[model samples]
Target: MEQLIQAIILGIIEGLTEFLPVSSTGHLILAGEWLGFVGESSKTFKIVIQLGAVLAVLVLYWSRFVSLAKDMLAWRFFRKGHLDALHIALALLPAVVLGFLLHGLIKQHLFGPEPVLYSLVAGGILMIIAERTKRRVTAEEMDDLSYRQALGIGCFQCLALWPGFSRSGSTISGGLLLGTSQKAAAEFTFIISVPIMLGASLLDLYESRDVLSSSDLPVFLVGLAASFIVAMLAVVTFINLIKRLRLTWFALYRFVLAAVFYFFVLM
Candidate 1:
């Protein structure tokens, strides 16, 4: 019963933070600490709930995703739609390569409260810097994104391999710095996130299979359902409101969250 409750709570946290500049992994770690849910299985649970959020993105962008998939399958490499597919792939490449290389090291060293808190603070500062120094918004929409810009954004996304340095935060900041507008950056961020996050979740599920049991299935299902439902709402709200929102505001929130966790939780 207690475990189920913790699962639901963590699921909500995952849903709320997954698409935002806030780090879902960081929040899950902190919440797990508070709820006494730390373990290999707990880590696995975090990754699994993230898939629920990824599912929300898929459902929300079903037509676009389907079109991208068709473009990929047909190898229509030079078509505009295929180019968009390539852009997402380029934006995912750097992180995917680096993450694959450093996966074990990152898991061993950075998946904890102390590292996460430091990353949260550092990521917040970076986001502010990106906003302040960003170039003029030349790319007003995702279709305006160039291959070079997409690759550059991917390089920035590598920062997210560090826990609490959020994937969305890194990518959106990268997009801003590369002259993309807020809405374009956010839409690109959301679209690009689906493949990588979904892949990572599946990989983690396979690797952590030894730790999970049939007994954990119900808890996992509950978390998955809660995360999916809440994530639908969160993503819709963000999309509707992002035009008027600023990354600096989210950055400030990250700063406060880090400080609070440091003083109250870590200390």
Candidate 2:
């Protein structure tokens, strides 16, 4: 029962932080440390539960995904469209490659409180600087983004290989720095996340298959369901919030959270 409760809490944390500029993995690591949830099963749980958040994205953007599928079947996806599949692919390429290369090393060494603490602070500073130095918006909409801009964002996403740097934070801030509007960057962050996270979740599940068991099924299910529900709400709220506000707020939150974690959790 206690494990189940921990799962629910972790699920809520995952959903709340997944799409936000604040790092989801960073939060999970810190939360797990505090909750005494460290182990292979906990690690596997964190990765697998991300599927719930991915499902929320799918449900919210079902029509867009369906349109992309139809365009792919008709081979019109390359011509022109709002959700350019090619651009997303371009944006995902760098991270996919780097993630593949660094997967084992990251899991073995960097998936801990110390690395996350430093990364959270450093990423927050970068986000603040990026927002302050943002240029005139050239890509006002996700579809307006050129392949070059998408590639640049992908390159920025490489920074997120560090656990606390945050995939959305790096990509969206990179987009802003590269002249994409905030709303456009946030939408693209959500859209491109489906493939990247789905792929990563699958890889983690497969690699950690030994951690799966009938006894733990309920815990996994409860966590997955909780994350899905919360993520749906979070995604919608974040999109609306980004339309009216800057990402500096999230950066500030990250800075404060890092300090709290360092003093309370790490110390």
Candidate 3:
């Protein structure tokens, strides 16, 4: 009962931040460290429970997803239908490739807090630069985009494979840099995250098969539920916020959080 309770709490934390520009990985690492949930099962729990949040994306955006599929199947969408969905797939390709190629190395060494610490700092700096550039020019919103822009965004996504750097942060920042409106960049970032997260979680499940057992499976399920519920709210909130807010706010938070982790926790 005691262990189960701890697992449940950890699961909730994982779900809530997984999609937000705020680093879910960083929060999970810190949560485990502070709460004494850091154990053999920690990494697997973190990865697999992400399914919960991923489902939230699917559930909340089901209409857009369905429209996308219908349009693509008929091969008629675009001006007639919404094809931003296809662009999302195009954007996810780079992360999928890099994730697969570096599978073993990333899984073995990069999923922990210390690695994320550096990522938080470096990624924060990158966010500052992205924000500055975005501020210089009013981002333009195009109803449709060229494949080249999507591909460029996808390439930027590859930078997110490093544990601490966020897939949302990189892609959103990329969109801003390339002259996409905040809303468009954020929407694309959210859509692109679904596949990237799904692929990673499935891979982790395969790798962690040896450690699975019936006894603790329910904990993973609970965490999934918690994360999904929380992430739905988080995603909606994020979409609404970014339209009027600058990315610098997140950069400031990351810098402060990193410093706290360094002096208070690490020391």
Candidate 4:
């Protein structure tokens, strides 16, 4: 019962932070550390439950995904003002290659609170700097993103390899630096996240299969369910928030959270 409750709590944390500029992995590591849930199996559980958040994206963007699929099948790469499959593929390639090369190193060294703390602070500063240095909004819509812009965003995503430097945060900041509108940047961040997270979750699950047990099935299910429900809400709310608010608010939150972690967890 206690374990199940812990799973639910972590699931909520995961859902709330996963899509936001605040790093979900960073939150999870801090939460797990404080809650006494840090372990190999727990790490695997975190990875597995993120699939629920991924599903939220699929549910919300089902139509877009369907359109993209159809466009690919028909080879109508540029029929209308929509992003082609090539754009997404190119955006994803950098992360795929870099992630493969650094996966082991990151898992071995950086999946802890100390590294996360540093990344949280650095990412927060980067976000603030990006937001303050505003540029003209060139890419006003997701469809307007060029292949070069996509590749650039993908390169920025490489920073997220360091936990606490959020994937969405890095990419959105990248898009902003490249003159993508706030809403467009947020949308693109969410769209590209589907493939990257799904692949990473599957890979983690496969590597950590040995740690999973039949007894942990219920915990996993509960976590997945909770995360899915909450993630749907978080994603929608975040999209709306980005439209009306500045990214600096999230950056401030990250800065404060990093300080709290340093005082409470590190010191």
Flag regions of model 4 displaced more than 4 Å: none
Query: Each candidate's root-mean-square deviation in Å?
Result: 1.3, 1.2, 2.3, 1.2
TM-score, predicted candidate 4 vs. hidden true structure? 0.96
Error of 1 at 203 (Å): 1.2
What's the residue-level lDDT of 179 in candidate 1? 92
Candidate 3's C-alpha runs over 4 A off are 75-81, 84-86, 134-143
How far out, in Å, is residue 241 in model 4? 0.5
Score every model by TM-score: 0.96, 0.96, 0.90, 0.96
**lDDT for residue 92 in candidate 3, whole number 0-100:** 76
Clashing residue pairs for model 3? 15-227
lDDT of 3 by residue, 64-131 (tens): 77877777788744442234555766787888988899977876888777888888888778778987
lDDT of 1 by residue, 32-103 (tens): 998999899998898888888998999999998888888778985445523367798788899999988987
Candidate 2 per-residue lDDT, tens place, 11-67, comes to 999999999999999999999999999988888788778889999999999998888
Worst 10 residues of 3 by lDDT: 134-143
Error of 1 at 120 (Å): 0.7
Clashing pairs for predicted structure model 2, backbone only: none
Report, for all candidates in order, the number of backbone clashes.
0, 0, 1, 0
**lDDT tens digits by residue: candidate 4, 3-99:** 8999999999989989899999889888988888878888888777888899999999999999999988998776446787877887889998999
